[model samples]
Target: MVGREGVAVAKWLNSLGFYAFVLVHRFPNSETGAQAPLDDGRRALKIMAESGLAPKGISICGLSSGGHLGAALLSEYPQVWTSPDPEMPQIEFAILGYGPISTNAAGRTIIENKPPLPPKEKQELYDVVQPDVQLRSPAPPVFIVYSNNDPVVPVTNAYRLAEGFTKSGAPVELHIFADAPHGFALDSPKELPVSKWPVMCEAWLKQNNWIE
Candidate 1:
């Protein structure tokens, strides 16, 4: 399941009896921008393995900035976590929301969290934050979702992620909603139909045997 930064969807995962881990380490407090969270994902996954939570494999799901880190965990594992322990669980599945995957500031049509023209440090941050530059081999299957009306993350980000997946011969599913906002499913449980995302997610996981 995916949600905003610090939303703690892991609690719901635990209530369902699935072992869950939340990523609490990152540079900027916000969910968007830069590579600090990718840096944090390494440590988080390491701890998960040390704590015996990610053994055979693990599925990652995220939103916007979190989604970017999720993608980094899968495709750019080499960069994110440099653990000498090759036992790091391979990311089996990833579900991404409106996130900027590979491309960084200079690569995208819409740039975020910066001035009209990016300054030096911000540019350096974007450069290092670009996942496309760090794409590694043997990528895992992915499900990507995006909305055209999302003011924060535009539709192109999803398109680029799919493109990278196909180019690398990785399995991928891209879903586009015509008019949902940036954090459309923020509180989906209170709503109907859309709240069924968890159901759909479970069905998908079961079909793949990721969860029994």
Candidate 2:
């Protein structure tokens, strides 16, 4: 899901002379399905560490499911079994845009308009995965950005996530714009490109000193 986006982002960072590394899966069967983008992010961080690229720390940027993956890295740390990968790169900072965090029981209905899921199957996965972030995990500081006009992932998802972080004593901030739509990075309704989210996103990382 993130290879091309990662490469573009890495290139953007490199243009500013930052050491950016993009992680692509080794072979076929490479899909990071569902919320599995979290694993992909971890693997990328691991690759950087093993290759001695950014051994000590790294910042992560993800959109939609990608953002959810970044959140999962913090909210579900221990349960994540990364096979034989190297030490997990300590996430210094994370930028999440339109991500989902809590996904069961009480919070399932928070999103007023999510695509219908199978009554038993997908909802169970939500129960299994998202709630693991109920303050049980050690989290890095986070930046949550959302567009209130999002037709897909409701803006409330971002608000709820920020609330969870705050309740857990995790430093988190949110930015909500009046007009923007789902997957804005791909196609924005505004005259400007949705890709501009990365501009403020990168600034957020630097503001927190997660990246130089």
Candidate 3:
């Protein structure tokens, strides 16, 4: 279910004079496997590039599982992420909101109820696609946001990703909001400081020259 928050974020970006594309995909279950979502994300990027909307570059912004897919696209497919068809625009930056970048760690918690895979297979799966494991040097700039009070995905996932990006010498900005629950999105309580994430994000984007 795409919430009003998602639409609000898109509209906010549009107001900032940025073209926003929201890509939605079916949940990756035991039958579909994890690769399906990644493929879907790639197809969306391809379509956007071919559409001629973003010629210089594109910035991806994702929340929750969407964030995970964005990270996978950037990390696992470095060749495509870094150097796509000359006709296609490259991914200049990414904004991730409460993403579980480490599949293994998240599997133990968020995906524990899903179909079970053997230890070796799980490890192999993580090695191939987990954003934290797949992170490399010269990656595109990343902006990560998470809340310490999140009850679903652990806050550590965000820290781990930020650490990995820093270790790889990739430009990264991290924001840890206190007392906000998971899935807050743009609907976070007005009383909470976390509700200002969108404003902070805009500042960050402008500072990085992402917005012209």
TM, every model: 0.76, 0.72, 0.81
lDDT of 2 by residue, 1-212 (tens): 55445666567777755687655533212243333444555677777667766655676767666665566666644353343443576677666777655643345756655554554433433555562245434666777878887766667778778877777666887888778766665345446545466677678767877567
Q: Rate the local accuracy (lDDT) of all candidates.
A: 0.63, 0.62, 0.72
Error of 2 at 20 (Å): 3.0
**Ranking of all predicted structures according to TM-score, beginning with the best and ending with the worst:** 3, 1, 2
Off by over 4 Å in 1: 1-8, 28-35, 77-88, 102-104, 111-123, 189-195
lDDT of 1 by residue, 23-75 (tens): 77545433444445565676677677677766676777777777777776765
Top candidate, metric TM-score: 3
- lDDT for model 1, please: 0.63
Q: Scored by Cα lDDT, where does model 3 land?
A: 0.72
Error of 1 at 180 (Å): 0.7
Per residue, candidate 3 scores C-alpha lDDT tens digits across 77-157 of: 543223333232467888888876774543444444544445443433444577876764567888899998787667888
Looking at model 2, residue 50 earns an lDDT score of 70
RMSD of each: 4.6, 4.5, 4.6
